[model samples]
Target chain A: MLRINDLHASTQGKNILKGINLEIKPGEVHAIMGPNGSGKSTLSQVLAGNDAYEVQSGTVTYKDQDLLELAADERALEGIFLAFQYPVEIPGFSNEKFLRTAVNAQRRHRGEAALDAFDFSAMAKDKMALMELDPDLMSRSLNVGFSGGEKKRNECFQMAMLEPSLAILDETDSGLDIDALRIVSQGVNALRREDRSVLLITHYQRLLDYIVPDYVHVLANGRIVRSGGKELAVELEKTGYGWLEDEAKSGEVAR
Target chain B: MKTATPDKSLTYRDVFASGQAEEKSWARYAAKRESALAAVLDRGLETRGLEEWVHGKAAGLVAGDALPVRGEVAAAGSPEMARVAGSHLLVFVNGVFDPARSEIGTLPAGASVQPLSAGDEAADLGSVARDVESSFTALNSLFWRDGLQLILADGVVLEQPVELWFVNDLAGEAGLIPVRNLIQVGAGSEATIIERFVLGQAAVVEQPLTEVVCAAGSVVNHIKLVGGEAAGEHFGSTHVVQRADSTYRSWEIVTGGHLARRELHLDLTESGAKCDLNALYMGAGKQRFDLRTRVNHDAAECETRELYKGILDGEARGVFDGLILVARDSQQTSAHQTNRNLLLSDDAVANSIPRLEIYADDVKCSHGSTTGQLEDEALFYLRTRGFSPEEARTYLAWAFASEVIESIPVLELRAELSAVVTRTLDVVDDTLMGELS
Candidate 1:
């Protein structure tokens, strides 16, 4: 459902993602792992159509449409969801309101009627239950004063609410504890379907133990140096990215 | 014959001469009026060295000699008027108490709300908002014919808010109008007072003055909702005094007036008194919104918190000057003042000044002010959530105002003020894409 051909992108005139190529068919869960400054997050941001990153030379085809040509909001309406690393703390906007608007926007994009408040609240209640989030948290400001675990859960709750066709989670497991990791993984695993795709971007192999991916791709210096099964994450977890760095610098596994 | 653009100070002198009724029975305070009139005419139409007139220019208003004491106009209100409460509207038309439009019902067991001209309490009218303090109050005292007087007997709790609607309209005439209000909440009494400025008038200058005195242990909530298509200048002031253990919470939501400047003063004279003063203002087009707060902590163990936020777009300007003074003997006093502004346009100007004076050896006082534009990260966050760029900007602006309006405990009033803030944002047909509708 997604194909990237030599995705070269940069931000603020500094090149980040360079000479990257990847493909993910429907229902495939792909994990992108890399060291610091390896362009893992940049790859996800570029895929989500973030304007901060300029696509110098790349063609990202999503379900046969030019993904890079769409605006950020248009990409979102087209069922592309990017769970940010740091969700903004909007002071006065409640979570319920924001999520409801998003859900309605998605429905409108699908040529469906908007849900009334009652129906929306009912849907939100079920999602909150599944995410193990407090019902009252929806009434509070979006991510304002929320704990790290709650924030991740809220992002998952939002993902569940929107049911995006392609979900790219950028470092969703960074600040979560073991319990929160399992819960967030469960929330993600529940959304896995034959028609939906997931891209898990992380820095560690611990998250892979919970939500096992169909394939693992290690990005090094903006290019995928290795791609294998889920066992590659466990192997990298034990050996670390040290061996890959040598191969990356030596131009050996640069494919 | 109307000097709509008089150029000199002596022009208002002629206005004062023809406006006052020196021999009337309610004119017992003619001596005070005479002195105030002198102060106004001497300071008249001159803003050269006035310390408080930083971005506020009243010389044009004074030079116009526009203080003709609101004459009778037809009581037809515009469709923009959104009354927050279903309670009685003590309508003050053209700055005078309009008995015809005011629909006051039976009060609590021992409460009374009437015109300032109807009772013997006129003797103590200027006790809180003294006429000698400022030229604006002096001018209001000089021209205010009738005002509101709300008195709650000791221990009486009036749940229904008393809404004083200052409904003023001058059609196309530039006129400086004044209205006054005196509220006395007795000891242990609780009340809520909402002052609504329903606008849809042009060339209207409103100078509303309010004085509130909360007795010992009393609780009072004051909400000032200023909005709706108003033009010209508006200079309003509210002075409050709190007794021991009394609590005063005020929320000023200013969304109208071409040049609106409001000053709120808090005198915590008794120990253990607590006061919360919050304000939210929005300006679009060429509108200028100025809000000032002065808090004097005169007693020990008193607390004060002042917060004001402003949103400016187009070439609008926002000014916030807050001053907190802790008396020498008022030890253990805690006070904090904060002012924040969001400028939507590059040409929009925001001036924030915070002053703190601590004479006491042991006191906690802090002040902070910040002026900034919308954060690109925040905008991007919303846009990524499926809102268009314009919708995201408008939604963020509207959310900035939500913090102030959500504090109103009265549901209907909160909803009404929220709608007014949306109106001030100039939402598309005021529907906000049916989100807030």
Candidate 2:
């Protein structure tokens, strides 16, 4: 339900993602594994309509509409969610209020009724339980003084409440312990549906062990050099991305 | 030391001379007024400058054709009322006590709220905050027509808060309004006092002084809200004296006048006394809000915590000057001060100066200040969460401000204040404007 054709993007006059082509169909989990500086996170930010990344060329199509034409907030209302690698700390804005606002904004965009406080608390309790989060997290300021794992879990909690059609998880496991990883992965897996798709971007194959992907693509030097079903992750995991980096360098030398 | 001197000194001397003929209750303070005028003259009128007044000039006498504020009530002018249940409200108009509009309900035992005229101000008024404290305090002592005197008997625990509403409505005329209040929380007594200054229709220069005395073992909460649509300036000062084992907390929210200046001086006079001051100042439309606070720990084991925040938009200016002084021999004193500001427009100005003077060897003291716009990453994060850009900015700005008022006990007042900050950042509900408009 999403397509990126030769998507070239840059930020601060530095080209990061060059000629990236990817397509995710409904109900599919596509894991894009790449080493550092391979432009995986940049790709996710560009897709989520981060204006900081200038789309130099190419186009992105989401559910048959021009995705780049939408602003960041519009993309969010249109069911595009990007779990930030570093969740921001909004010191005095309660997590509950932020969640309710996000939920109501989406509902309003779809012509649905906004949930009142009573209704919202009930929904939040269930989501909080599903993510194994502390009940007090709802009232506390968003991500302020939260442990790294708690911040990642909060991102997952928001993902569950937003129920986005395109979920882009960008290095969400970078700072999580094993237990937090399981809970976050379980939260993501529980929300998978026939009409929803996920673009899981990570540097390591450890997260794939929890939520196995339908397709694994090895990315190097801003390009997807190889794509295969699941096993590509295990192979790359056992040997590391060193061979891929060498091959990229050799390929550049040949050019 | 450059200090602000009043403008139009001749006008003030002439007004004081003409007032000598009136046989008023306060006519007894003729000598005090004369000395206060001398103090005003001692500063030299042309000085008109102070480092503290660089950003916010102490509003001077500019009331063209200023009228005599002779405790007169003209039709009982109305202003927005913040009705918190179990509150004793004293509404004043043009420096006159409005008995018809006030609700000085049957106060609890050992509690009394009286007009300053009814009390003996000769010996009690300047006992806590002397006129020489500042030029504004001197001016207030010189011209204050009427005020409120609140006293809680020793060991009296007041169950209700006292609300002081000072409304200045000049009927579209230029004038000067002065308000002086004295609060005495008896030893071991506890009380909460909320004060608001509202202005309407005409150019006005407001000089206000509030002196608070917290006796030993007493606790006092002083929440003052200063703002009005008056088209001129505001100069006010608050002096708090805390005795042994007493606690004094001050909450100041200022958002009014063309240029409003507030100076708060706190003295922890005895061992184990504690003081906490929190302020939120918002400005817009070329308006200026100046807040200066000095906390003096005069005894051993005293503690002080202070936090002030500012939000400025348009070409408005906000200045925060906070100083914590741990006097010599005041060992074991701990003090902390923080000031943060947010500028919304390029032209908006914020000046933050935090100072700490520690003379004792065994004291802990620190001060910090920061001024910046909203974080870009924070703005982007909010937008990516489905909030419109404007909504994102408002929510961020509100969070930045509501932190200062988080300690207010009443939820409804907090909510109203949050809405006020969200709407104008000035914390004034324009819709709540009273019939005085």
Which sections of candidate 2 miss by over 4 Å? Answer: A252-255, B1-14, B17-23, B28-31, B44-51, B61-68, B71-75, B425-437
Candidates, DockQ: 0.70, 0.51
Judged by DockQ cut-offs, is candidate 1 incorrect, acceptable, medium or high?
A: medium
Model 1 chain B worst lDDT run, 10 consecutive residues: B1-10
lDDT of 1 at B321: 84
User: A185 in model 2: Cα distance from truth in Å?
Assistant: 1.6
Mind giving the per-residue lDDT tens digits that candidate 2 earns over A84-160? 99999997788987888888888989999888779999998999999999999888889998999999999999999
How closely does chain A match the true chain A in each prediction, as TM-score? 0.98, 0.97
For candidate 1, what is the TM-score? Answer: 0.94
Q: What is the TM-score of each predicted model, taking all chains together? A: 0.94, 0.92
Backbone clash pairs for candidate 2 read none
lDDT of 1 by residue, B1-437 (tens): 12243233545556666555442422645776787788776666555677777656663356555655434543555334455555656877666666767777768888888877675545556788876667777777777666678888899998788888776665666566677788999999999888888554567777888899999999999999787674757778899999999999999988787878888988999999999988998888898888988899999999998889999889998899888999899999999998989898899999898999999999888999888988888888887778888778878887788877778878887677667677667777332447764
